[model samples]
Target: MSLGDDNGYGNDSGRTDDAYSTIGGTRQTRTRLPDGEGGDGYNTPRRPARASRSLITMAGVVVLLIAAIAFANMGGGDGNGNDGDGSGKGGSKPEAASTAATGTKPVTGKNGTIPSGFAHDEQGAQSAASNYAVALGSAGMFSTDTRRSIVQTTHDPAVVESLVAALTKAYSPSFLKNVGLNEDGTTPSGLTFVSRTIPVGTKVTEKTGDTATVEVWCTGLVGMAGPGSTKPVSATWFTISEKLKWVGDDWRIESSSQKEGPTPVNGDNRASTADEIAGAVEGYGGFTYAR
Candidate 1:
C-alpha cells in the first residue's frame, strides 16, 4: 500500500494562488471603492437597481442547489466527510475493542464468507490488507505445520500449496536462530519467544472487482524476553504488498513481498526489566484479525 495523501491534490494555498494567477496576477487583491455600494462618498455612477427577487423564487433556487449537492454526494464526492477528519463514511464507523480500536468495520461477505464480507469500499480493503500482513509475518510461519496453516488461512486456496512451499524454504532454521530462537523455532528455557506483527496502517495501490494490490506497513516485536537475555524483543518495520483475490467470501493473498523499515526512532524511556518482559509476554495474548 502506498503511504501518501489519498486526495492526490495540492493544498488550498496552491489552489488559491493558481486561481489568482489565472484571473489576473498572483499578487492581485480585492479592494472596494470608497463609494462602493453608493454610500455618502458615492462618486461612481448611480447604477440602476434591479428588481428584487420574489421570496418564492429565492427559496426555490436554494432548494435546487441543496438537491444538486445531495445528488453529487450520493454518487461519490471524493469520500471526504464535512467533519474534516480525512476518514470517509466507511472509516468513521464504530469498532469492537477485541479487534483493535480502528474506527472501521470488519470485512464481511454478502453471505458471511471470506473476502466477500469485506466492505466493497477502499477503507475496508485497507483494513483487511493490514491485518492480513500481520498474520502473514507472524512467527507461526516458521514452523512447517503452523506455516502451512497460516498460509492456507490467509491466502487464496488456489495458490496456498505453492506459497506454503516457498515460505517453508524462506524461513530456514538458521534464520529462526538468528532472530533469537532455537533451530526448531522455539525459545530456550526461561525465555518467551516474541514474534508478533502489528500493522500501523495500509494503503491500496490499485483495485478492481475481485482483485486488489495493497501494501500493509507494519511494526513488529521479535526476539526473546527472559532473565539474563542479551537479545530482548525489539521492533522492526516493513511493508507487505499483497495481491488479493475475493475468495472464500473474503480477500485472500495470492502472493506478497516484504521490504525493510522506514521506522521512526525509539524513545528514551527506560527499557522493561527482562523478567517483567517475560511475564508480560506470557500473560498477554495476540489477536485474531477479521477486517
Candidate 2:
C-alpha cells in the first residue's frame, strides 16, 4: 500500500607571497657628499631606506592576508558557513538537528520479529512508531494470520479487534490480485511479493506522560518481482503519523494516518533488474529503528 493508501489496511586552495630585494654579493660603496651638499644626500645610507620601504610593504601584505582569513572564517567566502536561517555568524556553524541516531540502544524485545517493549518516554514512543511502520508495511500484512499477529502486537489492545477487521477487508481478494498476489495473499510461483517499509527517521511532535504523536518518514518497495511482472518493485516516499499510548507497560499505537512525502529528488543511478531487486530484498535484513 502507498503510505496514504491504507483503506482499512496497514499504512506506512591557498597562495604564498614574498618580500624584499637582493643585490650582488659585493655591497656597493656610497660616496658621501659633505653634510649639506645637495639631494638630502648627507650619505644617510640607502640600505636603511630600502629596508624601511621593504618592511612597510611586508606589513601591508600581512594586513591584507589577515583580512582575507577573517572574511573566510566569517563565511564570507562560501554561503555554507552561514546558517540557512541566517542566525549564525560562522566559525563552524552548529550542526543542524538531524535524524541521525542518538546512540540510544534500540529496543531488544521482539514479538515475532517486530520490535516490542518500547520504553515509555519520548524516545521510546518514536522507536515504537518506526518499528510499527515497518510491521504494518510488511508483506505479512497481506496475509490474514500474520496481519492479525502484527495488529495485535503493535496496536493498543482496545483497538486491535476493529483494526484487524478493517485490515482484513482492506486486503480483499481483489486487492490481493491487483497487487500480484493470489486469493490467499501468497505470491504466484516463481514470484516474490515485496512490501517493505524502511523508516528514514522519526520525530515526536507532541508528547505527554502517556501519549505521543510521532511522524515517521519512510520509503517503501511494493509490488512483485519476477520475469514479466507487471507490477515491478517500485519505491515511494511518505510520512506516517501515529498516535501512541503507554499501554501494558509499553508503547502501542492508538491510531495512524499517512500522507505523501517530504520527498527528495531521485538520484541518477541505473535501475536494477527484477531479479536483482528480489535478491537484494531477500538478502538484506531490516533494522530496529530508533530516534
Candidate 3:
C-alpha cells in the first residue's frame, strides 16, 4: 500500500516505521507525527526538532512494551511454589490452587446402579454427594419402585423411610402430570423423558469424624422430548447440599437439600428439536465423576 508524500510519514519519508507492534497479543500500526506545519521550498521539507524527539519517544515506548512482555513471559515458579505473579501452575502438586483438579481416580464400585465404595475421606464425601445428586435428579426418581430403590441405596438407613415418604408425596400424580409424564410417571408411547443431573463441581463445607457436609453444584436436563410434546427438554442449574455419613465402608447421604443456581447468561445457540434432544440423550453416556 502506498500513501504518497501527501502524508509525511509515507515510505518516501526518512523516518517511517515499517514494522507493527504487538501489544496484549494484538498487532497495532505505529502512529506517526502529522505533517510539519510548513517547509523550506517547492519540495524540500525540513523535519523539525520535535519530529526527531517524537521518533525517540516512540522508540522508548516500544522498548518499555518489550520489557513488560519479557517480565510476563518469565512465568516461573517462585521458591514457594507459586508463579512470581502470585498465581500457581494449578497442576499435580500437593498444594495446588483451590480450583485445580486433584488427579484422583474414579470410584470402582457400585451400589446397585449408583457409584459406591468411595474412600472414607473428604474426597469420598464429595464424590458420594455428587453421585447422589445424579440419582436424586434422574428419571428413575420419577418412578415408584426405582425411586424407592435409589433412595434406599443412597440415603442413610435411618432417614430412608421418611425421605422416601416425603419424595413420594412430592412426585404425586398431579406433579407427574405437570411435568408432562403420565399419572404414574411414565412417558407417552412416542416420547422420551429426560431427567439427569450433571455435577459441575463439589466442595466440602464441614467435615468431622464420621460426617461431612458437601455441596454439589449441578446442571440438569428435564422434561419430555418427542413429537407434539408441550414440555420440551430444558436445562436448569442448582446446588444440592448433602449431609453425608460414612457407613458400611462408604459415604451415604443422611439428608440433602437444593437451592437455585449461580446461573449464567444464556448463549446464542439454537435450541434442538425434541427428537434431536432425545436422540442425543440415548446416544451419550454420563461420566463416573472424580474430584
TM-score of each: 0.57, 0.67, 0.66
- Screening candidate 2 with a backbone cut-off below 3 angstroms (N, C-alpha, C), the clashing residue pairs are none
In candidate 1, residue 262 scores what lDDT? 52
Q: 164, model 2: CA deviation in Å?
A: 0.9
Model 2: how far is 111 from its true place, Å?
1.4
Off by over 4 Å in 2: 1-95
lDDT of 1 by residue, 190-224 (tens): 77755555655555556667776665545555445
lDDT of 3 at 221: 57
RMSD for each model, in Å, please?
Answer: 24.4, 30.4, 26.4
Q: Rank the candidates by lDDT, best first.
A: 2, 3, 1
Please give the lDDT score for candidate 3. Answer: 0.48
Q: 1-291, model 3: which lDDT tens digit per residue?
A: 012223211121121121111000000001111222332111221221121111110000100000000000111101121211112223333343655667889899987898988888777777776666666556666578976787677767865565455445544677566555789978889888766666677767666778877656665555456776655555545455556788878887654333345568766676677788889988998677777
| Best candidate, TM-score | 2
Q: lDDT (CA) for every model shown?
A: 0.40, 0.48, 0.48
User: In candidate 1, how many Å is residue 130 off?
Assistant: 1.7
